[model samples]
Target chain A: MNLNNIYELRWKVLPPLAGVAMIGMAALALVTAPTEVIEGDVQRLLYVHLPSALASYFAFSVTAVCSILFLLKRDFKWDSAAQGAAVVGLIFTLLTLITGSLWGKPIWGVYWQWDPRITTTLILFLIFSAYLIARKSSSLDSDKSARFCSIYAIIGFLDIPLIHMSVRWWRTLHPQPIIAKLNPALPDEMLLVTLFSVLAVILVAAWFITLGVETELLSQRLLKLRAIAKINISEKS
Target chain B: MSEIGFLFAGFAVFWAGMFTYLVILQVKIRNLQSQIDLLENIIENHDEV
Candidate 1:
C-alpha cells in the first residue's frame, strides 16, 4: 500500500483496534489473572497502577525527545507534538498517583505518604504540569514560549531517573522495582497479566498522543488562516 | 472498606479518568475541525475572487 493508505489505516483503524485490545486485556486481567498469595485481590490494582505509571514515563520521554527535536529544528510540528505528549503524560501521571494512593490506603493504612518513590513521582508530575502551564502563558511570544518549555522539558526529565531509583537509593516505604529487578518477585501468571496491561496501556497512550498532536496542529493552522483572512479583509477595505 | 471494595474503586477511577480525558480531547478536536472547515471555506471563497 502507498504511504497515504498507510496513514489512513493508522488514522481510521488503529485506535479502535487498540481500544478493543485494551478492553480485552483489562477483562482478562480482572477475571482470569491469578491473585498474589499475600496481597490477594487488592494486588490486582497493580495491573493498571503500574502500567499507568509506565505509560506516563513513556509519554514524558516522548515529550522530552520531541522538545529537543523542536529546539534543534525550530519546527512547529515538533512543537505541537511536544505539547501533545506533555498533556497526555500529565494525564497518565495523575492517574498513576491516584491509583497509587488508592492502592496505598488499603495496604499501607493511609492514602498519602512522604515515601521516596511517591514523592519523587509527585515532583515529576508537578514539573511537567508547570511545563504545560508555561506553554499556555500569553506573556511570551510563541517561539520564546516553545523554546522556554523545551528547556524546561529537558530539565524535568532529570527527575524521571531519580523517581525510578528512589526506592533503591534511600530508605522508603515504597516497594522496590519488581519488573526491573534481576529477579522479579511475581509469579508467572501475574507477570504475564502485568505485561499485557502495560502493552495495552502503551497502545492507548500512543493513540491519545496522536489525537492530541493532530488537534494541536489543526488548531494552529486554523489560527494562522484566520489571521490571514483578517489581513486580506483589511487590505480590501 | 473491604479489600474488594478498594479494587473496585481503583478500577473505577482508572476507567473514569481515561473516559473523561477522552471526552475532553474529543470536544477539543471537534471544535478545531469545525474551525478548520470554516477557515478553509473562507479561503476558498476568497480565492474565487
Candidate 2:
C-alpha cells in the first residue's frame, strides 16, 4: 500500500483502540483494584498520576532521540517527529503535575510542595515549555530553527535523570520508585492495574504524537505550496 | 472536600483534560487540512495559468 493509505489506516484504527483500552484501564483502576486501607479512594489517583509520569518520561525520551537523529541526518521529518513528541511530553507532564498535586493534597496536607522530586519535575516542565515557545517564536530559517530546537531538546532531556533520582538524592515527601525496584511496593493486584494504566496512557501518547506529526508535515507542505504560488504570481506580473 | 470528593475530582480532571486536548487536536488537524487543500489549489491553478 501507498504511504497515504497507511497513514489513513492508522488514523482510522488507533483512536477507537485507544479509547477502548483506556476505558478498560479505568474499570481496572476504579473497580477491580483494591482500595488502600489508610488512604482509601483518594489513593486511586495513583492510577492516573503514575501512568502520566511514566508516559511523560517515554514521550520526552522520544523527543530526545528524534532530536539527536535530526541533528545527525539534517532531515526535516526528524525535526517534525521531535516536535510531535515534545508536544505529547508537555501534555503528559502537565497531567503528571496536576494529578500529583491532587493526590498530594489529602495525603500530604498540602497541594504544593518544594520537595526534591516535585521541584525537579516542575523544572522539567518549565524547560519544555520554554523549548516550545522558543521554537514557535524564533525568526530563524527552517534549518536553523530545527537545529536550535534539537539542541534545546537534548539539553532539556538532562532533567529527566535528575527527576528520576530526586527522590533518592534527597529526603523528600514524594514516595520512592515503587515498581522500578527488584521488589515492588504495591501488591500484585494494584501493580497489575498500574501496569495496565501505564500501557493505556502510552497508547494515547503514541496516537497523539502521530496526529501531531501529520499536522506539522501538512503545515510544512502548505508553506511550500504558498511559496511556489507567490513565485508564480511574481513571474506573471 | 471529602476523600470521595477528591477522588472524583481527580478522575474528572484527568478525563476532562484528555477530552479537551483531543478536541483541540481534531480542530487543529481539520484547520490544517483545509489550509493545505487551499494552498494546493492555488499552486495547481497557478501552474495551469
Candidate 3:
C-alpha cells in the first residue's frame, strides 16, 4: 500500500490495539498479578494507582514539550497539542488522587491526608486545571489564548518534579518510590504486571490526547469559517 | 467496609472514570463534527452566491 494507506491503517488499528492492551493489563493486574506479602490484596491497587501517576507524568511532560514548541514556533498546531496533553494530564492526575485515596483508606485508615506527596499532587492537579480555565476565559482571541496557556503549561510543569520528590525530600505518610527507583522492591510477577500496566496506561493516554487534539483542530477550523462568514456579511452590508 | 470492599471500590471507580471520559470524548467529537459540517455548508452557500 501507499503512504496514505499506511497512515490510514495505523490510525484504524491503534484504538482497538490500545483497547485490547488496556483490558489485558487490567486482567493481569486484578486477577493474575501476585499479591504483596505485606499489604496483601490492598496492594493490588498499585496496579492502577501507580500506573495512573506514571501516565499523568507522561502527559504533563508532553504538555511541557509542546508548550515549549508553541512558544518557539508560534504554531496553533503545537498549541492544540499542548492543550490536549494538559487535559489528559489533568484527568489522569485526578484519577491518581481518587485511586490513591481508595487505596489509602483500607491501608492507612484514612481517605485523605495532608502528606507532602498528596499535597503536591493536589497542587499539580490544580495547576493544570487553571491552564484549562485560562484557555476558556481567553476564547475571544485564539492566538493570545494559546500563548497564555502555553506559558501556563510550562510554569505548571515545575510542580511535577516536586510531586515526584515529595516523599523522598520530606517526612510524609506516602511511601517512597518503588518501581521508579534504581533498585525496586517488587517481586518478579508484580514487577512484570506493573510494567505492563504502565505501558497500557501510556497507550490509553496517547489515544486520549490524540482525540483531544483532533477535536480542537476541527473546532478551530469551524471558528475560522465562522469568522470568515461574519466578515463576508459585514462587507455585503 | 471490608478490605475487599475497598478493593472493589477502587476498581469500580477507575473503570467508571475511564468509561465516562471515553463517552465524553465521543460526544464532543460528534458535536464538533456536526458544527463543522454546518459551518462548511454555510460558507459554501455564501461562496455560490
The models' CA-based lDDT, in order, is 0.84, 0.83, 0.82
Misplaced by over 4 Å in model 1 are: A1-8, A139-141, A162-184
Number of the predicted model whose DockQ against the real structure is largest: 1
CA deviation > 4 Å runs, candidate 2: A1-9, A139-141, A162-184
Residue A152's lDDT in candidate 1: 92
Residue A225 error for model 2, in Å?
1.3
The digit string of per-residue lDDT tens for model 2 on A1-237 reads 899788688777888888988999999999999988778899899999988888888888888999999999998888878888888888888888898888788877789767666777788888888888887786323799889999999988976676667644665455644322222378888899999999999889889888877777776777777788788889999
Docking quality (DockQ) of candidate 2: 0.77
Instruction: Report clash pairs, candidate 2.
Output: none
The TM-score each candidate achieves on chain A is: 0.87, 0.87, 0.86
DockQ of each: 0.78, 0.77, 0.78
Residue ranges of candidate 3 with Cα displaced over 4 Å = A1-10, A162-184
Ranking by DockQ: 1, 3, 2
Q: What are the candidates' C-alpha RMSDs?
A: 3.7, 3.9, 3.9
